[model samples]
Target: MGKQIQLQDAAYILKAGWKLFSRRTSLETLQKDKQYREFIRHNEAAGRNNVSDEGKRVYAVATDEGVLFFSDSGKGMKTRNSYLQHLADSFFNFSKGVETLKLYEMEIPSRQVMELADNSIDKLAKSDLRNAGTQLRKSEFSFTKEKMAGKEMLEGAVCTDKYDLRPDYNNFDRLTKEFNLGISPRNYDVASLLYISENGYAGHVVADYFHPFSYEYEFRDLAEKLDDSIKARQSAPMSLHDFGYAALQMEAKVMARDILQSEFHITDGEFRLSGKANRTSQRTKTPEKCLFQQSKEPEPEKSGCQAAKHVSSVVPQKKEKKQLII
Candidate 1:
C-alpha cells in the first residue's frame, strides 16, 4: 500500500488545450514555501468545484506518488472519465511535442487501463516515488452555470488511490496480449509511440494504426522495434514519470538534430558519422583523463582592485516574495 507523504520534490504545472505551457519552481523553493503547499491542498480539496467550467484548466501536478490530476465536470465516474481523458491527452501532447491528437474521440478501454497500470508499475520499479500510494477522490458538482440551451453538464471530482504496483512484466507482446482490446485503427498507438520515443522504450508497443505516410511508419516502426529489443530482458518496468522526462528528452533530441542538420552540414552520410564517432569518444573519457587531456593555458590572476570591481559588478539584489491569488 502506498502512503501519502508531503510532495517534497520540485513542482511544475503542465497545462494542455489550444497550446501546451509549463511553469516550474525549484525543489528547495517549493518545499520550503508554506503558501504553495496550502494552495495545492486547497485546490485538491475544493478548487475544482469553485472554478467555472469555462475557466477550468486541465493540468497535472507531478508528485512523489504519481501525477495528480484535477477534472471537475460532473459527479463520480463522469469526473474520473474526464480526468482520465485529459490525462491521456496530456500524455499524447507531451509525447508528440504538440496538441494535435483528437483525444476526446479516442477510447479509454480496459486495455488502456491496463496500459496505465503497467506503465505505472514500470515507473515504480525504476524509482522510489511510487512507494507512497496515490490519492484519488470524486464528488458531485457543487457549482453550476446557466445551461447552454439543451447541452448537458457534468459535475464532481474523483481522486483514485494507487499503490506501488510491482512491475514484474517487461514483455510488451506478452503484456499487450493479456488484454483483449478489439483492434480498430486508431492513433492511440501513435501517442504511445511518441511517448516511448520521447521517454525511451518503456515496455510499450506502437499500435497497429494506419499511417498516411510511408516515412512516418518507417520512423515509428524503427523506434518501436528498437525500444522493444532494448527492454526484452529487463525486469522492473519503467516509471510513469519517465514518460514526462522522456518527452522533454525527445523534444531536446529533435530540436538538436534539426538545429544540427539545418545550421551545420551535419545530416546523414559523412558529417553525421563523424559526429557520432566524436560523441562516442567523448563518452569514453574518464574525469581524470579529461582533466589531464585539456591543454588550454590558465589566465593571469586578477589584482585585488580588479577582483573587487568584478564582484561589485556581478552581485545581485534580493527579490521580493511573490503572492498567490488562490
Candidate 2:
C-alpha cells in the first residue's frame, strides 16, 4: 500500500540507521583495525581444508573487542590459554611466600560472570612494579633490572594507554585460599592467575613479588597497617631490593593504621587494635613511620636462603620503559 522507496534511498536510510546503532566508542575507534581483522577472518574461513590438526586459530587478548592488534613482532604469542597459565604459575608459587593455602584455580563459568554483573549493577563498584623484565608491569608499578637494585631503585613512569601486563582474574584469590592437605614443598599443587594483556600481546609469569614474604597490601588504612608491615620486614633478609620492598610494605601498613588511629582518638606513641582489626596494626613507634631505612644494609639471614634464592629467580631481567600501572 506504500509507494516503493528508491533503492538508493533505502541504502542511505540503512546506512544512517547502522551509524546510529553503532556509535563510535573506545572499541570502535578505528575502521581500518576492524577491517583488517575481518579480512583475516574471511581468508581463514575460505580455506580450512589445508589446515593440519595442530593448527589453531588464535583470538586477540582483549578486554572488549578491539583493544588489541595482532602483529608478528609480538613479544609473546597472542592467546588466552598460554598467558593466563604463566601468570597463574607465577601467582601460585608457594616457594616465595608463606603458603597459607595451595593456590588452586579452575576456569570461570558463565554463572559466576553473570552473578558478578548482576551484583555490580546494584552497587557503585570498586574497583607493582617491577624489577627486571623488559616491561615490569604492576597493578601500580614498573621497573627494570637496572633500576631494581641498590640506592638507584626506580620505577618506570606510568603508561597513558590502557595496557595489561598479563591477565589475572583473581588477584585476590591467593589471599583467602588455604591448603587443606598437610604437604611439604608444594611444587605441583600451587594455583595461578590468568590475565589478558592490553596491547593485544599477551604473556604471563608466576605471580611473584620483589619481597619474599606473602605480604598483603590490603589494609583498613595506612597507619593501622604499618606496624604489621614492619614486622613482615623483620622476617625478610637484608638485600638491595628487600629494603625497597620493605618500605612499600611499611607504607601500605602504616597508611591504614593512621586512619584507624584517627578513629580511636589515639595519639602517637600509643597503639591498640584487636580482633579483625588486629589484621591492620598501628605502630606506636615513630621509627615505623619512616619509610627510608638507614643506608647500612641489613645482613642477609641465611635461615631461608633457599626460599630467598627461589624468590630472586622470579624477578625479571629487562630494561623497561617504565612500570605498567593498571
Candidate 3:
C-alpha cells in the first residue's frame, strides 16, 4: 500500500489535463520530489531484473493541449521534441485519406418518389397488411387512400388509429398518448391530409424542440417510439428534421431495391437517377395515369393525389406525350 501510494503520487504529477506537457517545470524539480524518487527506485529495480538497460520504446501521452512523446533509447532530445510535428503530419495524411474514401447515398428523385411508393404499395400492400394484423400490431402500418395517393405519400408513413385506446378522437391528441406514424414531412403531421400533394421535402433541425410541453408532444412521442426503426447517417442527438430525412431515405432505399427486380428499367443505380415527375400531363391533361393500363379514364381532379404518377428520368424528354422514360 505504501509503494502504491508513492507510484500514484508520481503518476498524478505526470498526468496532464488542459495544460501542456512537462514544459512548465524542469526534470530536476521532479527528481527532488519524494514520490518521484520512490517511483524511480521502483522502476530502476524492475528494469534491472529484466536485464534491460537500453531504451528503444516510444512512449506517448495525450493532453488537452496536444500529444507528447518520449523515447527510452537515451537518444538526443531533438528527435523526441519533433514527435508532435511528425504526429501532426501523419494525422493530416490520414484525414485526407478518410475524406477521399467517405461513402454517401445518392439522393433519390423527389418527384418520382411518389410513383415509386405507389408501385411499392401496390405490390407490398397486401403483404404489409397481413404482417401488421398478425404479428406486428403495435407498429403495423396500413395503406389508406391518402397514403397510397397523397402528395406526401413517399415522404411519410401512417399507422392505424384503432390502437390508440384513448377516448380522445383527435389525431394530434392520440399521437401524444403513445402513437406514432412511421415518418412524416417537416411541419406536417404523419396523418395530415393537408399539404399531402405539395412539393419539396426540405426541413430544418430543431434542438430539444419536442419536449412534452414543447407543443410538439406528439412529435416527441413518435420519435421515442421510432427509436428502433429510425437509423441516422449523421452524428448523435438527431432532431425531428433529421428523422424526417432518415425516414425518406429509408423509404427510397426500399423502393429502389424493389425497382431493381421490377420490370421498370428506369434506373440502374449508376447512370440514371430519380427526380420529380412533371405535374402537367403531356398526353391529355387528364387527372392522372391509372395503375392498370387496361382502361384509361379522365380521373376527377378532386382525387388530386390519389393516383400514382408515371415516373421519369432526370433527363429532359419531348413534350409530345406522357411516357415512362428512365
Candidate 4:
C-alpha cells in the first residue's frame, strides 16, 4: 500500500524537489524580493510582460510507484484544471511509471512557496547560478496568459449522462489498458481526460457533468507512437523530436528518483518503475549529450569574466532580503 503524507509535508518535498530539478532559483522568493519585483515591473513596463503567474499556482509530482502528489496555491481552480489536464496527459503519454494521481490542496498561498524557493536558490554557488540561467532557458515551459487565452476549448458533443453512466467506453478502456491496471474504468477515478482530435489538435475534457466526448477515442497519435518505440525494450532509432522528449522524460525520472530517495528516504522497491526501466543514467548525467542538437553552429565559449559580465547585464543583482507586502 502507498503511504499517505500531509499536504504540508508534500509542499516541503516539492520545494526540495524543485530546488534540485528546476533551473529557477525560487519562484516565491524572487516574487517577494522588492528588487526582483521592481525588476519584473520594469520588464513589464518595457512590454516584456512574460512574468510567472501571480495567481494561485499548482505543483504536481508523479512517481513510478503510481503515486502523485499535488500542492495547490489556493484560488485558481480554472487555471489549475487546465494545468492538471496537461500534467495528466504528460504522465499518461510520456511517463508510464505513474499509476495513481493524488491532490493535496495547500493551505499556504503561492507567494510563500516562491519565497521558499528564493531562499534555497540564494545559497547556491556562483557556478551553479551561471549554469542555472542556461539550464532555465533550455527547459523552461511557460504558460502565459495570452497563450492560455488562445487555448482551444473542447467543442465536441456534450454528454448529458453522468460519467459513470456514459456510453462511450473507448477512452476509459484505452486508459486502463495502457496502465495495465486490474480495475474497471468505472472504478478508475480520473481528474480529467486528455484527447487528441481527428484533425490532430489536442484538447481536454474535465471529468465533470456534461463533459465533452470525442468519437475519435484513439489517444496515441503518430508522434506518440514514434515516441513509444523509444521506450520499448528493443529500442529503435528516434527522430530528433522523439529523442528530445525521451531525454526530458529520462531526466525527470532521474530527478524524481533523487527527490524520493532524499526527501522520503524510501527504498528503491517503494518507488520502482512500472515498466522495463530504461538504463540511461550515464546519458542523463551528461546533459550536453541529452540536449537536442541545433542546426546552427554553437557560439564559442565565453571567458569567465565575459560570461559573468553578460549574466550581470541580464539578471538583476539580488539586493538585501526584505519582506514583501503581498
TM-score of each: 0.20, 0.20, 0.14, 0.19
Error in Å for residue 321 of model 2: 22
Instruction: Please report, in order, the local distance difference test score of every candidate based on alpha carbons.
Output: 0.27, 0.26, 0.27, 0.29
Q: Write the per-residue lDDT of candidate 4 for residues 1-326, one digit (tens) a residue.
A: 75454443345436445442233435555456564553444334345346353333233222223212122211122223333344334432222333332232222324434332221111324443244121222222333232221101111111111111111123333333433323322222221221111112122222223433332143334335433534552253333334444343343335434533343232232322443332221111111111112243544323111100101111111223221110
Where does model 1 exceed 4 Å of error? Answer: 1-75, 94-190, 194-215, 220-326
Candidate 2 Cα errors over 4 Å, as ranges: 1-46, 50-83, 92-218, 221-250, 253-326
Q: Which of the numbered candidates is closest to the native, going by highest lDDT?
A: 4
- The whole-model C-alpha lDDT of candidate 2 against the native structure comes to 0.26
Question: What is the C-alpha lDDT profile of model 3 across 152-215, one tens digit per residue?
Answer: 2212211111111111112222222222222222212211211111211111221323411222
Q: Report the CA-based lDDT of candidate 3 relative to the real structure.
A: 0.27
**Clash tally for model 3:** 9
Q: Is candidate 2 or candidate 4 better by lDDT?
A: 4
Candidate 1, residues 216-317: lDDT per residue as tens digits? 453554455544533542332453223233343354336434533343323321123334521111111111111111134533312101110101111111
All candidates in order of TM-score, best leading = 2, 1, 4, 3
Give the per-residue lDDT digits (tens) of candidate 2, residues 1-326: 84454343344435434432233412334234553354345445446668532232222222211112111111212122223333334433322221111111112212222121111011211221123222213322211122112221111111111122111222223212211111112212111111111111111212333212112223324324443544455665353334343344444435434433444322221223342221222212111111223354654322211110101111212223222121
